[model samples]
Target: MFRLVVFVASLAVATTTAAHFPWLYVADDSEPRLFFGEGLDHREYHLPDAVAGAEVWQEAIDAPALRLEMEPLEEEGFLGLAASQQIEPRGFLRTTIDYGNYHGSRLIYDAQHFPAENPEAWPEPVLAPEGLSATLRVEGDQLVVVILHSGAKPLTGAKVTLSNAEGGPGLSAATDDNGSTRFSRAAMIDGLNGLMVMHVDKRATGEISGKGYASTTRILTATFNYRSREAAKVSALQPLPQAVASFGAAVSEGQLYVYGGHIGQAHDHSRENLSGYFGRISLDGGGWESLPAGPPLQGLPLVAHEGQLYRVGGLDARNASGEEEDLHSVDQFARFDPGTGRWTDLQPLPGPRSSHNAAVLNGILYVVGGWALAGDSDGEWQAGAIAYDLCSTDAAWITLPEPPFKRRALAVSHVDGQLAVLCGMTEEAQLSKQVFFYNPASRSWSEGPDFPGSAFGGFGLSAWNLDGKLYAGGMEGVLYRLAEDRSEWEKVDEFQTKRFFHQLVPDGRGGLFAVAGASPTAGHTGSIERLDLVFAAPTARR
Candidate 1:
C-alpha cells in the first residue's frame, strides 16, 4: 500500500509539472520569443536549458524555412528569437525540446508562434508544423485551435486549455474528432492568449538519451496576441454612383460591380425610374468607374465566380413615367467580363425571374426564390430553383427539385457545402422568417432555423458566406453570424444604418461592405458601410 501511494504521488507530481509547458510569443514588428510557463504564470526560474538551447526556425507559405537566432532574455522572463528573414503573415516560429525524464516519465515540448493580431492578414492553407502542434485560426467570431499529431493525424479527445494574459479561470474544452475546439471570442479575455494541449502515451515507455521513462508526454502550445475589446464599428465609404435599391452587386478580383435597379419610390416601377447604369470601383478605394450601360432592371442579384460577374433574370419596367406601370421579368442571363469590359449573353434562365438572389458553390451558380412579374398581372411565384455549371463547355440552366414554399426578395448563400435560403416574402405577400437548406449532393431540402428577427425585418434580407462563415443582415440592422453547428444565428454586430435590398460582399480585407440599399430614414441610400472584425482591448482586470 505504501508503494502504491508513492506511485500515485509521483503521477500527481508529473501532472503538475507538465502544466508548465513551453510557449512562443509573436507580435507585430517585434522579434518573436519563447518561454516556459503555465497559464498566465511565466516561470523565469523554470526555463530549461534544453528548451533554451533548442534550434529554432521560422516557416511561411511559399518561403523557405530559415533558422533564427536565440537570445536569453531572463530579465524579460522569456527567450527572444531573431529571424534573419522576415516572417510573412500566416508564418510561424517553431522549436522542439526533449525535456528528458522527470517524475517517472519523459516530457517533450513543442512550441509554435502564430500571428494573431490581424486575422484578416493570415493567409490560408495554414500548414501545421511537424510533430504534435496546434494551429490557430478565426472563423466568424470564434477562435479555433486544431491540434494535430505526427504532423497530419488529428489528435482526438485531447483536453485543450486557453488562458489570456489577464489570467483567472481560463476556458477548457476537449478536441473533437476533427481535433478542433472553438472558443467564443466574446467570452475570452482579449490581448495575448495562449492555448496548450497535451498527449500522454503510457505505452510510450522508452529511453531518451539513456534516460529511461515510464511513459511519454507530448505537450504542444500555440501562443498569439490579439485584441478584441473594441466594439465593431460601422463607417461609411464612398457612396454609390446613384441611390438605388433592388439592384445587383458583386465583388470580383477586388472590385465592386453594381448593375441596374429601380431608382424611384419603393414598389413603384416605371421606365423613368429604372437605372441602366453599370459601374465598378476598386475596393482598395477609388471613385466608381462607369461601364457601358445594360438593360434597366430591378429585383435581381449578381454573383461572382472565377473573376467574372453573372446575372440571371430580372424585373424590367417598360412603361414611361406617365403611363401605367408595365412590368415584366426577363430571362436574359449574362456574364460580364472585367477584362473585355463587356457583357456576354449566356443561356437565359429557365424562366423569367425577379426579386431573387443567387450563390456560387463548386463553380455552379444557383438562383433561388423569385417570381415572374408579367404586365398588369399578379406575379407568379417560383417555387423551384435553378443551377448553371460555369465550368462546363455547354452551360445551361438545370432545374432543381421544387422547394415546399415560394418566396421572393430572398437571400441565398452557400454554407457547409449546402445552400441556405434565408427569409423573404411568401406567396401570400406576407414577410416570412422561415429558412430552408438545400443539399446539391443529395438533391434534397431540409428546414433550417427560422430567422430570429420579426417578419417585418425579413423582407430584403441579405446573406453571404464569407471566409467559410454565414452572415446576414436585414431591416432590423442587426448583423448575425450562424453558429458553427448550423443550429442558429447569434447576434454579431449591428449596422449603424438599417437598410434592405443591399448586398453584403467581402471588403477584400477580411471585412464586409453593406452596399447601396433603401434605408428606413434615409430613403434610397447610396452609402456604403464597412464592417471589420476588430477586437477591442479590454481594461486589465482590476
Candidate 2:
C-alpha cells in the first residue's frame, strides 16, 4: 500500500511540471524547451520543422488540461519526451483519451518569428551618399565643378574625377597648367528637386615646398533652376558745345546773323573795343562761317531792311595811346544783300557813335545811345535815338525820342511796329535791370517792367514775337517773357549753360536757335542750342 501511494504522488508531480514547461518544436528533430510564466498561455508545436525553419505551429489550452503519458503501474517523474514511432496517441499526450485531448492536439496553427517584425517603435538613421565636395555651379546646360586649391604654384597634370548623383558612370580629366579642368556640354539633371547629386575630386600641388595634396571630396546637390540666357542691343546723344557770341539776334532766310558789341576778355578789363566782327551761320550747311575782315566800325550794329543787312557805326581798332579812336570818321554804314552776298555803302547814321542799338520798323532802321565821337573821353554817351526810313529813295537818318537810360549793348526787337529795348549795361559798365518801350506811331519812350536779374557785360539779349508775347534772354542765360499788358516780367526757362555774346535767332517754329557765345571760362565755342517757345493756357482772373 505505501508503494502504491508513492507512485501516485510521483505521477501528480510529473503532470504539474509538464504543465509549467512546454516543448517548443522548431522542426521535426528540433525541440527547444521553454518555460511558461504568468502571461504565457499558448505553445506552438511545429511539424516537419528543420532547425532553420522560419515558422512554427502553435496550440494554446488551459494549464490544467496537460496530461502525462506513462507505462502501466509506472511512477511518473519529469518526462523528457522524444519523437518515437512506438509512442501511442501519435507522439502527443493528453489527460483523457476522449475528444477533449484530441481536439486540443489538432489546435496547432502557424506562428512566424521573423526578426521580431522589425520593431516599428524606433526610427532608422539615413546617411547621405559619400565621396564628393560641396562647391559646384551650373554653367550653361552642365554642372560645372570648380575646386579652389591652396597653393602658390600652378597645378599641372593633376587628375580630377566627376560623378553624377547615382553611383553610375563618372568622368575623369587632367588639370591643365592653371590647375583648372573644364567639362563642356556635360548632361546634368535639373536641380529643382532634391534627388540629384554631384561629386568632384581634384589633385593639386600645395604651396608648401615639395608637398602635393588633393582637394577634399566635394558633394553637390541640385537646389534651384539655372539662370536664363540673355540677348545683346545700342547705347543716348552727346552734349553740344556752349555758345560764344551774343544773344537776341535774328535768323532770316537760311543765315543766322549776329551783330554789335564786344565780348570782354575778362572782368578786370573793359570790353570797349567797339570794333566788332559780324558773323553768320549757315543753317543749310550747319556751322558758323564768318566773312573775311571787313571795314572797321564802332558798335558794328546791324539791321535788316528790305532784304538788305545794314551795319552801323562802331569804333575802329585801338590807337597808339591805348585808346579807341574813330578810324573811318563817318557815320559809316555798309549794306549786305542776301542774294548778291555783297556789301554796298548806305547812308550812315546822322551822328558818329559806337555802342548803339538798332532795329528795323516799317522799312526804317532805328539807332539809339552810343558815344558820339570816336575817342570821346568825357563820358559822351548820348540818349538820342534816331530812325532811318529805307522806303525813301534817299534814306536819311531822322531823330526820335531819346532812350530813358544812357546805356549800351541794349538789345532791341520790333513787335507789331513797336520797338522794345530790353536790359543793357550802363556807362559805368554795370548791368542795368531797367527796360523801356518805344511806340513808333507815338514817337515817345515809356517805362516798361524791370528785368528779372542784373544784366552783365556781353549781354546776348534777344526778343521775339512768340504767340504775341515778347520772349527775351540775358547774359546769364535767364530767359524772361513779358506779359500781354507789358506791365510785368516773368522769368522763364534758363539755358543749359551761361550764354553771353551769342545770337538768338528766331527758329520760325515757335522757337529760337541760340548760336556762337563766348564762354567766360572756355573762351569761344561755336555751339548752337534751340529753345522751343511754349505758350501757357489762359486762366480766369481771381
Candidate 3:
C-alpha cells in the first residue's frame, strides 16, 4: 500500500535514517572504493544498476581530470566498485548516483572524497556535481563548513549532520544565511574518516524509471578525513625580562633581540617608566640573557639584515613622572654586530624622527610614516619618506618624494619590490585602517588593501615578511596574509590574546612570535606567545 503525501517547506526532514548515502573512501597510495551505507556503520544492500554503473572522476589541483576504471567489489562488508588505479594524495574523487525512485520520491546522491593532507593542497571542483556539496577551512582551532548547491550557490538553512567513522547518531546543525557553520576542531572525533552529510528535499513532480513521483530529494555528503590535531598551534612562551610597548625588536643569528621601550601604563609617559633594558633569547626556547643596555628609548624601528641589527631614530623622555614631560626625537642611526658584541654608529637620519617604521628592501633601508617629537609640545607630522643604501660605504639618508598622509605607530613591510606602510594613528590622533604602498622602482605611491579589523586595529599594528609572503596582525589578534594576487588581505588564523603596540617576529620555523605589549585583559604583560603552522599526520584507512 503506497500513498503520496504533500510535503511542505517547514516539515522537511533528512533521509539519514530512511535512506542510504553513497560514500567514496579515498586513501593515500590506495585504490578508492565506493560504497552505499547508513552513516559510518556499513551496510550491504543489492546495488542499483544506475548507481553501480555511474562513472567516477578524479580531479587534481595541478593536473587535468580523468575518468577512472573500476571493478566490482565482492567483499562481504562493502558492496560497490573499487577504482583500478590508486588516487594521488592531493586531489578529490567524485561521482553521482541516481537511486531511481523510492517511497513515492526520486533520490539522487552526490558524494566527494577528500584526502587527510593539508587543506591548502585540496583542489576545488569545477561544479557542485553533488547538487549539494561542502568545503572545509581551518581557522585557529575551529573547522568551518560551507554548504553549497549546484553552480556553487550557498544553500541557506540546509541541515548537515556530522558523525565519526566508528559510528554514532552524530550532531546536526543548520546552516546560516551564508550557508556555513563552525565546529570546534578540538571537540570532533578523531578517526580515519569523518562525515558531513547534508540533505535537501525539494517539492516537484517527477517521473523516474516509469514510476510517477510527486517530489525529488537530493543527498549530498562530504566525506572528510579528520584527526584531533592542531593545524596551527599557539602556545605561550617565556615572558620577556620586562613588559614593555613601543619597543625595538629584531632577529639575528637565530636569536631574538629586544632593545628599548616604554615600561609605563598606557598613555603614561615619564623618564622613570622608560626602559633601557636589552636582552636576547634563543628562538628554540630559553631564558632571556641580558645584553649591554642602550639609551632609554621608545617609538623606534629595529630591522635585521646579514646577521646584524639596525636601530633607527627614536624618542627619549627626560622628565620625571608627571604632566611636565620632555620628549624629543633622536637622529641617531646605529647597527649592532652580534659577532663582535658592539654597536657601530652609522649615518644619521636627515632629521630626528620617531614613531616611524622601517624595512629592508634589496639592500636598502626605507623609513616612512612618522613625525618629530620636540619637547612636551605637540609633535610635528611629516609626509615625506626617506631611504638609505645599506650596501654602499657612503650610506646617507636620502629624502624621497613626500607621501600623501602623516601617521605614526604603523607597520612597514617590503614584498615584491613594494614598501607597504600599514595602519597607524594619523596627524589628527585618529586610528585608521588605510594602507599605502610605495614602489621603489617606480617611485610612485599606490594603495593596497586596507587591513581587516576595527578602526583601532590599525593603530600600533605589526607586520613581517617571510619568504616573500607578508603577515600582519594588531589589536584584533587575527593574522592576515596578502593574497597571491596582491588584491586583498585574507585571514590566516586568530589567537586569544589581543593587544596593540606589540611586535610579531618570525619564529624561524614558518611561524610567528608575539612579544610583550599592553593587553586589555592583563594590562601590561611581559608574556610571549608563539604561533606555528602545523598539519596532522596522514589519516589511515579504518
Candidate 4:
C-alpha cells in the first residue's frame, strides 16, 4: 500500500508540472523533426506525459501527403519525424496538432511554401477535438457561440468569454443548458472581423492544480472563413532625387504627391539647403516632376481627400545656420487641388503643433495627438483629438475629448467607421505601444491594442489601414499587419532596406506604393518600391 501511495504522488506531481501549454515546433538542427513541448521555445520545454498523445493530420486541409503519423522520440515525449510533405498548386499544408486535453490544440501553417500558381479557396481548420470546443456562427447581426465538453456534450452554465482579438471591448457570458450564447453586433469590433476566440474556464472536471488530473481550460477559436489572398510582396522603386526625412505624401488623381522634407537623415542634420522640394510621380512608371513648392515644411502631415491634397501642422522651416527664421510648429492649414493645380488657404488649426496624425472617416477629418512649442523648447506630448467637417461650410474645428494618454509621431488609420491610433514616441522620449480608438458616431475614445512586438517610438514609425486591418512599421524596417481580433501582429514581410518615413499608399489594385524614406546607415533613398498584398479573392462568409 505504501508503494502504491508513493506512485500516486509521483503521478500527481507529473500532472501538475505538465499543465502548461504544449507548443509544437520544427527542430532546425535536424531534418525538420516535429517536437511537442511546453512553450514556443521547445528546447526549454518537453511534452508532458499526461498529454503526450499527439497527432499531425492535414487530411482536413486536403493535403493527405502532408499528414504525419506521429510517434514518441523515446517512449514518451511527443517528438516525431517530419513527414515528407508536398504542396498543392494553390493551397495549404494546414496541419492540426491533437495533443490531447493538456496540450489543447495547435494549427501549423505551411501556406508560404506552396505559392499557388492559381490560388483559390483558402482551406480552414475543420477537424478538432471537443475536450473543450467552441462553435462559431453568424446569425443575423449576432455571432453565436456554443461551448462543448467532448465535441458533443454541452458545457452548461460555464463561464465563457469572447474577445474580438483586435484589442477592444470584450464580452462575457454564461453558457445555457445547450452550452450556447451569443454576442450581438454591438459587442463586436467592426472591420473584417478576423479570427476570434471563445474561451471557457470553470471548476468542471479537471484541474491544472488538484485531484481531477484533467485540464479545466478549453478554448474554441473559429476562423469563420475570412480569407486574405495577399502575399506580403515587396519590390524596390525608382530612387528619390535626394535623401529626405519627415516628409508628407499623398495619392491624388493617378499621381503620387510628395511634399517638403529635410535632406538630413533624422538626428544627423547638416542644415543643408538642398532639401525642402515638393514633387510628384505618375502611377504609370513616370519620373518625378518638381511641383510648386508649398511652405518649406518638414515633419508635416499630408493627406488626400475629396480629390484635393492638404498639408497640416508641422515645422515650416529650420534655423539653418542659426540664422534663418523657423516656423516652429506651424498651425497653418491649406488645401491643394490637383484639378486646378492651385493652393487655397483654409481655417488654421486652433494651435500650432507637429508630429500629429490624421485620418478621414466617412466625410470628416480628424487630427489627433502631437507636440507644440513651449517657450522655444519642444513641449510635452499632447493627448488631444479634434474633428472637422470637410463638407461643412463652417470650417470650424470641434474639440473632442482628449485621448487616454499623450503621444507623438504615432500612426492612425480610419477603417470601418473607426480609427486606431498606433505606436509612437512618448513625452519622456521613450517608445510606447499604447493604442487608442475613436468612434465618430458615439464620439467616444477607448483603449485599443498595443503594437505587437514593436516599439512605437521609431524615427520612421507609421500606420495605415488595409481591408479593415491595421499595419504599422518602418521604425525597424519590418512591416507588421494587425489581426482584426488583435490577438497577434503578423509580420507580413520585411524590407531589404530598413527605412522610416517611407510611404505606403494603396495602388487601387489591392497593393500600395512604398517609396522615399531615409535609412539610418544608407542616408536617404529615393528608391521606390511596390508591396502587392497579392491576394485578390473576394472575401466570402463561411
Candidate 2 residue-wise lDDT, 1-542, digit = tens: 00111211212233422222122222122222221211012222221222122122211110122222221111132122232222111111211011111111211111111010001100111111332111233333444433323223333454444432223444556656654565543333221111112122333213223333333222111111221211000001011222123322456675666654433332211234332455666554444455543554434466666666777776554453244442323477777776776778877667677656677776777777666544445546667888877778776778887666887767776665688787777778777777788898787788777776655622546555565577777566656677777777666665543456555666655666655455443333344555654653333211
Which residue ranges in model 2 land beyond 4 Å of their true spot? Answer: 1-249, 259-264, 267-279, 284-293, 296-298, 319-330, 376-379, 428-430, 455-460, 520-523, 535-542
For model 3, the local distance difference test gives 0.73
TM-score of 4: 0.53
Clashes, model 1: 6
**Candidate 3 per-residue lDDT over residues 31-132, each given as its tens digit:** 887776666556465566766787888764223577889778776776788887865544577887777676676767788877533343334565753477
The TM-scores, one per candidate, come to: 0.56, 0.48, 0.56, 0.53
Model 2, clash count? 32
lDDT against the true structure, per candidate, is: 0.74, 0.44, 0.73, 0.55
Q: Give one digit per residue, the lDDT tens place, for model 1 in 1-542.
A: 00111112324573544556666765445566667666544545456678768777766422357677766665464433344333433446778888888776787777777653444223232344546877765655787888888768789998887776666666678999999889888756556777777777788798767878888777777777565632133223456766688899999888889998878556667887888988988987768899876788988888888998888789888988768989999999988888888889888887899998899999989999899999989988898899999999887788999987899989999899999999899898898988899999999999988887688777897898889988888898877777787777777766756789988988988878888787654446666777664441212110
Which of candidates 1 and 2 reaches a greater TM-score? 1
lDDT of 3 at 115: 59
Error at 414, model 3, angstroms: 1.5
RMSD of 2: 42.0
